[model samples]
Target: MFKKLSIGRDGADAQARGAGAEQRALDYLRRQGLRLVARNYRVARGPSARGGEVDLILWARDGTLVFVEVRARERDAHGGAAASVTRAKQRKVIFAATCFLRALAEIPPCRFDVVAIDGDRVEWLQGAFDVPAEH
Candidate 1:
C-alpha cells in the first residue's frame, strides 16, 4: 500500500518564483562588476524603533559601499515593480543601513540601489535614493 500527500502549491510556487528572481538579480549585478559583500543583512530593533533588513550589500571596485533593495513582481501590473519601493520602504532601508554601518569602525562612501525584477527583465537603479538622515 502507498499513500499520497499534497502540499500548498500556490504558496510553494510563489516562494520558488521569488527565490529565482533574487538569484537572477544577484547574477545580473555580478555581471555588472559589483562585488557581492553580504546578502539579507538584518538590523535588530532599537528601544523605540522596530528593526528592518537590507536585501543586499555590495562593494564597488571604487570602494563604494552599496545598499541594495531587490523587488520582484510577476508582472508590471502596478507601475512596475521598481515603483513599489515607496518612501516608507526607503526610510526603513536607510534606517537599517545606518545601523549596519554604525557597527563598523570606518564607514565607507555609501549609496542606495534598487534592483527590480519584472518577469525576465531586470532593472538596476543606482543611487536610487539619498541616504536618510539619522532619526
Candidate 2:
C-alpha cells in the first residue's frame, strides 16, 4: 500500500521545495521574535495506525507552544498550498501536538499555525485551528 501511494520523483521534489520554504518561514518567524523549538516531529509509525509527523514546533515569548504547518505553492491558481491543510490534517497535527506535550513534564499554552509560502510571499496564520477533543 505504501508503495502504491509513493510520491516518486515529484513527491521528492515537492518535499525539497517545501523544506526550503519552511526554512524561509522559520527564519522569518525568528526575526519576528519567535523562538525555534523543534522541526519535523514525527508521531506515527507507518501508514496503517502508523505514525504521523508535524512540520515545525515553536515557542513564543509568552510561553505558548506553536505547532506550525508550512505550505508552499507557485501560485494560488487552485486554493493555494495553505488551503491544503484540511480539517483532517488539522486533527492529525493536534493529535501529534498532544503526544508531544504528554512527553513533556510541563505543558504550555499552545496553538496551531499555518505558514503559506506563495512564490516570494510568506503569510503566517496564527492559531490556525483548535485542538481536537480526543487529543
Candidate 3:
C-alpha cells in the first residue's frame, strides 16, 4: 500500500533536508519494488524513557516487513552516512519497529534497512541492524 507524503516544504532547513533524503530513499526503494507501508513512524516514551522513530516502513516482495532509517551526509568521511547510525540510533529504530509490530495481526519476517545517502550516492543496506540481545 502507498500513501501521499507531504515532504520538503518545511520551514527548518534540517527538517527539509531530512524529508528530501527520505523522499529520495523512498523513491529508490519503490524502484526496487518495495511497497511502502508507513512513513515516519514514531513512539513517544515520555519523560521516563527514550522514544523512537523510524523513517520508513515497507513490504518487500518476499513478504518481509522492512523498517528503514535514512541517513545523509555531504561527503563520505569519518564513516559518513551509514556510520552515523550508531548503537543508540539502532536502539531507537529497533524500539520503534517493536512498537510497529505490536499493531499487526500477524508479524512477517522482518529486517532493518538503511539508506545511506552520501552526496549523490544512495546505498541500500538490507539487514543493517538487529535488535540488540538485551532488547
Candidate that would win on lDDT: 3
- Residue 70 local lDDT, model 2: 88
Residues 13-103, candidate 1: write the lDDT tens digits.
8878766776887898899888888888888878957777888898988899999999998789998989999988898898889888998
How well is each residue in 53-105 modelled by candidate 3, as lDDT tens digits?
99999999999999999999989999999999999999899988998999999
- Report the lDDT tens digits of candidate 2 across residue range 1-135: 355665556877878887898899999899878998899888865454745568889998889999999888898858887888888788778767877889999988988999998888899999888876765
In candidate 2, stretches whose alpha carbon ends up further than 4 angstroms from where it belongs are: 1-9, 46-50
Using lDDT as the measure, what is the rank order of every candidate, best first? 3, 1, 2
TM-scores for all candidates: the values are 0.85, 0.86, 0.89
The candidate maximizing TM-score is 3
User: Would you list the clashing residue pairs of candidate 1?
Assistant: none
Instruction: Output the worst ten-in-a-row residue range by lDDT, candidate 2.
Output: 44-53
Compute the lDDT of residue 25 as modeled in candidate 2: 90
